[model samples]
Target: MMHRVAGAPLAFAALRSQLEVPGDFAPAVRAEAAQSAQTVELPPEDATDVPFVTIDPAGSRDLDQALHIAASGDGHLVSYAIADVAAFVRPGGEIDSEAHRRGETLYFPDTRVPLHPPELSEGAASLLPNQVRPAVLWRIELSGDGSVRSVDVRRAKVRSTAQLDYDGVQAGLDRGTLPDPIAALPDVGRARLALARKRHAINLALPEQSVTGDGAGGWVLALRTTLPVEQYNAEISLLTGMCAAQVMLDGGIGILRTVPPPDKGAVQSLRRAARALGISWPDGAPAGDVLDSVDRSDPRHVAFIEHAVALLRGSGYTPFNGAPPSQPLHSGIAAPYAHVTAPLRRLVDRYGSEICLALRAGIAVPDWVRVALPELPEEMQKADHLAHEVDRAVVDATEAWLLRDRVGDVFPAVVIDADERAGTVVLDSPAVRARCAGADLPVGERIQVRLVTADVDQREVRFERADSSQL
Candidate 1:
């Protein structure tokens, strides 16, 4: 299902221009941003002494989440702080409208089109290390067994004690020498993951491809595995989102991130896929449990995980005012959830955090947040579509450029999917997936594939079965 014409441009300039992305802010947007720094009010709580630290990519400045975990009486207290984006952008202002138009931050290869102006999202609102920032703080208390005991949301002022990345944190954890204040992340994260599994949470195992500088005026696609501490860190955000959804449901007014359970047909298809791949998915085992047992480093298991991604679709934002929805589960997370973290990068989190705050404080939900609840679904859905398109386009373009001169080269590839017309094969060296015209391409089987075409202008690539191709 792909078309390729080699020797096109090696840069993303063509794709960015082709997509016609909004690359600059409007005059009105700029005007509002200049005033926001002075007009934006901060909350009246100073928790700077809590020793919170920002953990993100090595050089990332748009830090959205920071935390300080400690052992409380028979449990742990997780003081998770998220950037308070709503506090800076006034409702119906130019910044607000512009953010709605953008919906969310779009990250490309080397740059990003931020939802809000840099003054706020990156400079002021961001929780940079050692900087005092306003945040929507989640105070979650958990029992010894990792079950959540209570949750509280509030507006507060805080400062990050340090900025740490996953690799650094993992190294520290491995050596058992992380500073005392932040040493509790692994323990709490593992406990929370245990609770998630108890409720059937499904964590997909797939390597992600990232583009990095080649140091010669170009980029290279790198396939990286998700580190153990990274998953542990993500479990914190998941715990907060689940707590947010529960609060919204109990308060009877908010939006939720929802995904319906997989249907009988999807499950049947997955079972068939597993059998075709010669993977034994036990008859009565839950899909999550079966998936957790596979070694992801194996190509066959990668193909199985690829098929598993299809079972977790139909995701969307659902808003209600007077009552909770009957089916509000986010099947991927295996729990009810909402977007209450990463407000600096996302829009829904700002409104959801506001609603949760109001509900926690026994105050009326803000009129502005109430009005935006129903409208957020459409906005977020559209933004999500654009983000996905950009992501796919960038990857396709990069793959084409990387393979431009190797059209006749043969490589080992595993079959990810197959249909009557063609089968999708993934090459390990470049870590790119391309559809190859073939027959009897058994799913998950490793075979020789030759690159037939790679076109950067069209951002397409096609392959052929090297077993019988015109070598």
Candidate 2:
């Protein structure tokens, strides 16, 4: 049930301390940030010919990428420019060592510890609104069939025409008055939508959850999914990143983000669950195929998606100096992938961009980059976990705070997951996922429940079935 808790702070003091960013890094980092801000040269302030716009959450200062799209001889050409973190952080320098130690930017509910200091990350390096900045750019051509025809990567100076947020772009698309550069969104969106549907045809469609701040020291948990435009924009980034990973892998060098494919046992378990829920499966068909036939609106489907999410567990950073992992495919994107789009926030992107830069130049990869490459996977893994842990701790605490006042409220909810003993239910009225107990869940069943208790300090929401059947 949705209820509000007032007067409680959303941010947790202990988690913030645990996620404590080494704001007091070596003196070299400060000097480098200051030097970086001063010596950096921006491109012509008047190079406004390209209709590039920065798309990010509203109030996002550490913008990492800017994009522009245009028609190119019966195909579409997209130019993406990412902040060039490599250009500034010298090899093995203080900032480099510190960033290597941290791996990535850490985000929390109330604050963020940038991988690079604001003077760089959110300031000079960011492709901020109306600012000309140095960038490593990727230009890609896609045929009508959504296949890549060619790719170009280089260093360039560019300026953003405007800053746009996701919902604004979605609203513009819905209104049919999108700006010219983004008018292609709907077309590309449809193509990407088809691509996702195809993947679903062969894979599970998982329901992922993202937590949002409620402005009053609490959180509103939202069931996030690949919105049409979100998926469309992501495809462009993914294609480019995949191309970069391919080029690197083919060259016998570079780090790739990988997650092992799901096991047959899990697939079988999902199949049994599907049969229990009355969903049809083709003879000897894969779990992915069965998922495609299910109705997402049904509570059973939500449960299936949550279970499917387990298939993507244990994703990590993988580095290689020629021989790729035994498995190169990223099951989520259904392609091998690398991090190349957000140099401003990710240390590995700086190295990936450098590799792409060198590959484009037809030069041997720089000794500095090659030497530093071996250590990146671990550093990046630590950073990734730290960032995620901070975000998770904050959101969990905030959700607990928000529900603290609604102990007796009841709301409609659907079962989204079940184990041998307990399960989870997602409240339908508002954006919240809560824990359900007792043996009555039945995995995919829908039922009403009262908020038995909400403990902000404990960071949990306990629910009971509204029906007297529990009694």
Candidate 3:
């Protein structure tokens, strides 16, 4: 189910150069990171006895989090440890200045532009298995119903007992051989999912298109479906973020990841699309509920889910000092959330983690952190924009390369979106989504589309309706 595209490496290299992506770290930053990696002191509090394990994609070096869950009475006790990037990067120091300039890690199919030098991000500061590293530990006690009863976060020295990947963990769970450290994940994850449904949170089960190496020096484009264990792991992270957001709100100062509620007009449009697609929408069901009911195996259902993506818009970081912002909820999550779980990859998480730790310890927020809060949102926004551009451009170019030899061939596709004269289509064979041009393209319907143009240099791929094309 994967298609190998030729000449992708050269095309991607040219694209990166054109984007002016940052290269290796500056010499001063590298030297500072190397020294700090060797000499940084571990926190006094030791949680190394806790058997924490990390779950991420295979071969991920810059690990950010490790977790262990256990039964606490009828509920569960979750011990989450996040990499403490601040331990090695001093305020206004070389590494810190370089990280601020980078904003966040930029990921491409071939490689990544790390936020910090490898000496720290991939070495000392990473939560690699058996390594005693500094961490921001979150100890959360949850009720039987999965509601958080109490939360605490602080610095500590911790060690990960194992490094797990999603596929392996899910396989272990399926065989009833999962380790004890995270055996409670399914129970807690199911409970939390019930709560999310009750709160009308949107959970889109859409397959993501990704490009990877084919091992023979070519690029393969494929669709990756989310495994059940991945959802459970994500729920744990969400719980911590919600807890952090509450702590910051109580302290009256911090930044929040916020999104406005879906617009009424957009909701109506989605309802109309559902009707056109022959999907049922009850009188009182929320969009999330309606989406959850759809069978993802159906092509029409996939198209409808793609259309619902429009409901999530206007998301941005909201920084506040004295009073909390008017809108603080991440509508997709149906709760207030903060970015404090991935400090190694994201610049904002380090600052957010520092604020939460200071508030919990009853100490004044550091002046350096306070002064940087206002500018953090803009910096993160720019980084986010760049990341999106890179991902989209890379995919577009790869898709173009995949279809370069079949410009006149017609392929079966689903019209996921439409306007008066143009729309978007998803082809299943190659797992590609690109712009389609024709008159009155039907949305959420299977149709034949002919590839008209596939230009790797421009990262453009276009199709025309088979019936409308003159050939």
Give the number of the best model, judged by TM-score.
3
Comparing 2 and 3 on lDDT, the stronger one: 3
Steric collisions counted per model: 0, 2, 0
Root mean square deviation (Cα) for candidate 3: 1.4
Q: What is every candidate's alpha-carbon RMSD to the true fold?
A: 2.8, 3.0, 1.4
Model 2 agreement with the true structure over 79-173: per-residue lDDT tens digits: 88888777677787777777777777877645667788778887888888777788888888877656678988888888888888888888887
Model 3, residue 165: displacement in angstroms? 0.7
On lDDT, the candidate that comes out on top is 3
lDDT of prediction 1: 0.85
Number of colliding residue pairs in model 2: 2
Task: Return whichever of 2 and 3 wins on TM-score.
Answer: 3
Q: In model 2, which range of ten residues has the least summed lDDT?
A: 1-10
Q: TM-score of model 3 relative to the true fold?
A: 0.98
RMSD to native, candidate 1: 2.8
Arrange candidates, best TM-score first: 3, 1, 2
Query: Which regions of candidate 1 fall more than 4 Å away from where they truly are?
Result: 1-9, 468-471
